[model samples]
Structure formats: C-alpha cells, structure tokens
Target: MEEKTYKIMSGSGIMNVIMGISAIALGAIAGVMLIYSGVKLLSNRQGITF
Candidate 1:
C-alpha cells in the first residue's frame, strides 16, 4: 500500500485562506455593529409615561 500527501500552498489554496479570513472579519464587524446599534437604541429609549 502507498500513502499520498498533498500540500496547500498553491495559489488557489492561499486565496481560499484569504477568503475565509475575510469572511470571519466581516462577520465580526457585523456582530459588533449589531451590538453597538442595540446599545444605542436602548440608551436612547424614553420610558412610557403613566
């Protein structure tokens, strides 16, 4: 039996890594924005008057 191994240093592989990193960064940014907006909305809310 023979075993084969492959390396992932090719151009497409590197591009895939970059794309994955970008997706993660974008998701983080979106989450931060959502939290920030929620906080802002809560802070600016006026309570109901009786």
Candidate 2:
C-alpha cells in the first residue's frame, strides 16, 4: 500500500510540474501577443476607423 501511494504521489508531482511549465509558456505567449498588438496599434493610430 505504501508503495502504491508513493507511486501515485510521484506521478502527481510530475503532472504538477508539467502543468506549471505549460501555464508559464502559455502566459508568455499571451504576453508577447499583447505587446505585439499594442505596438501595432500605436504604429497605426491614425488608420483606425471606428
């Protein structure tokens, strides 16, 4: 029973690490996209028609 519990715990830990890394990567991608859009908007400020 203890061995099974240890295995489960280790698996969970690995999953947590993977999830954390993926979240950070996703956040970075979103940040880059937002920055790019902001820069584009600033450059085209006079072309906006709304």
Best by TM-score: 2
- How displaced is residue 42 in candidate 2, in Å? 0.3
What TM-score does candidate 1 get on C-alpha atoms? Answer: 0.72
- Best by lDDT, which number? 2
Please give, for residues 1-50, the per-residue lDDT of candidate 2 as tens digits: 99999999999999999999999999999999999999999999999999
Q: Per-residue lDDT of 1-50 in model 1, one digit per residue for the tens?
A: 12222343466688999999999999999999999999987987786344
lDDT of 1 at 23: 100
C-alpha lDDT of candidate 2 relative to the true structure: 0.99
After superposition, the stretches of candidate 2 with alpha carbons farther than 4 Å from their true spots are none
Clashes of each: 0, 0
